[model samples]
Target: MAEFRQAGGKIDITATKAIAYHEVVVIGNIIAVASHSAKIGEKTSAYTEGVYEIKKGNEEITQGAKVYLTTDGAITATAEGNTYAGIAWRNATANDVVADVKINA
Candidate 1:
């Protein structure tokens, strides 16, 4: 299990394997680009999702891309107009980097 403090609150994860409420700290290469609609107030707004980081190979990624990360380590990019309901990246860019994702419990 891993624990961290965020937004003046303590977050804890006790899963033997990575779960939905567990924060994921990933360091990999960008694999692809995705996009979706981001809601502003009560309306849907156009926005680029984010990049998918793979273990290897070069991928074209953009800011505001929408991707579905499977539990088996598979990333599927989607361009449909949908609001992501899980953890979202605050800063979306094309640069290959590490990301710390905090899942809401």
Candidate 2:
């Protein structure tokens, strides 16, 4: 079988604060991940337009579920008061530190 799908592009932004590598951050639908360590007010590599493998804390998420950015620079299933980051591309267990998401930034 043959199939075709779409992916995302990389974008950079000025960090509001220090961000670790692969940490997910979101301001509304504008989601991104720090490609490397970036200090506050410095330009860091952020993938705002592409799928990213981000860090998820102890929270578990299902496949195809919508992921949100937390206050502590993390991803989770709870979006009650969080910023929408992207969609989970796979199911993530509670023990899994990483979650795959197709970011819609």
Candidate 3:
């Protein structure tokens, strides 16, 4: 089984006997801002993908802004100037995959 842990919550994945890796992606307008954490074991890999629409908050994040992830996890963000438009993740294990993202309001 796989596990996912975030700063605000956690989830125990029950679908591991069939999948060795999982990737999730989201793209749209971001109305809210949030942060999260993720961890991947050594047997599975997980990835998260999405696009963020900057509606508020500080627009200092550039397209190459550093997006931090948990151990063995990675985050990629694509933004136009200070407006972030997309986000992605790459998990290189089967530990805990968790992250926080913005939603379109």
Candidate 4:
């Protein structure tokens, strides 16, 4: 028989950079939200599947729209050359700095 691990909703990650709690982090092609603060090279838990408030770029995002992470790390509706983060859980105007995103959904 195979040994079962913990649930998949959360997982341990080694910080590539100093990460603050609730911060959005990109690991390879996967995007996850930091559940707690951690310094670079330290291991910390992060949410792989959850809705979280993430910083957004200058674009209006509608609910259920696919959200992507720009090179600068902010979430946006654009997908060209950017990393797919998740779906927007709510609408966000261009002027809004934050959007509710379903991370890794």
lDDT to native, each model: 0.29, 0.79, 0.30, 0.89
In the range 1-105, model 2's lDDT, one tens digit per residue, is 957553446566788878788777664468776678888988877677667777788978999998887777678999898788889989999999988888873
**lDDT of candidate model 2 versus the reference:** 0.79
Per-residue alpha-carbon lDDT of candidate 4 for residues 9-97, written as tens digits (9 for 90 to 100): 98789988899998878888888888899999999988889888888887899999999988887998889999999999999999999
Runs in model 3 deviating more than 4 A are 1-47, 67-105
Question: Which candidate order results from sorting by lDDT in descending order?
Answer: 4, 2, 3, 1
Clashing pairs in 2: 8-50
Local lDDT at 55 for model 3: 24
Q: Tens-digit lDDT track for model 3 on 21-58?
A: 23331222221222322234223222322343322232
Worst 10 residues of 2 by lDDT: 2-11
Task: Estimate TM-scores for all models.
Answer: 0.28, 0.70, 0.18, 0.89
Indicate the worst ten consecutive residues by lDDT in candidate 1: 27-36
Off by over 4 Å in 2: 1-8
Off by over 4 Å in 1: 1-10, 18-59, 79-105
RMSD (Å) per prediction:
15.2, 6.5, 14.4, 1.6
Q: On TM-score, who's better, 1 or 2?
A: 2
Over the full model, what C-alpha lDDT does candidate 4 score relative to the true structure?
Answer: 0.89
User: Which should have the higher lDDT, number 2 or number 4?
Assistant: 4
- Per-residue lDDT over 52-91 for candidate 1, one digit per residue giving the tens place of the 0 to 100 score: 2332112333334444344334332332432222232443
How many steric overlaps does candidate 3 have?
Answer: 14
Clashes of each: 9, 1, 14, 0
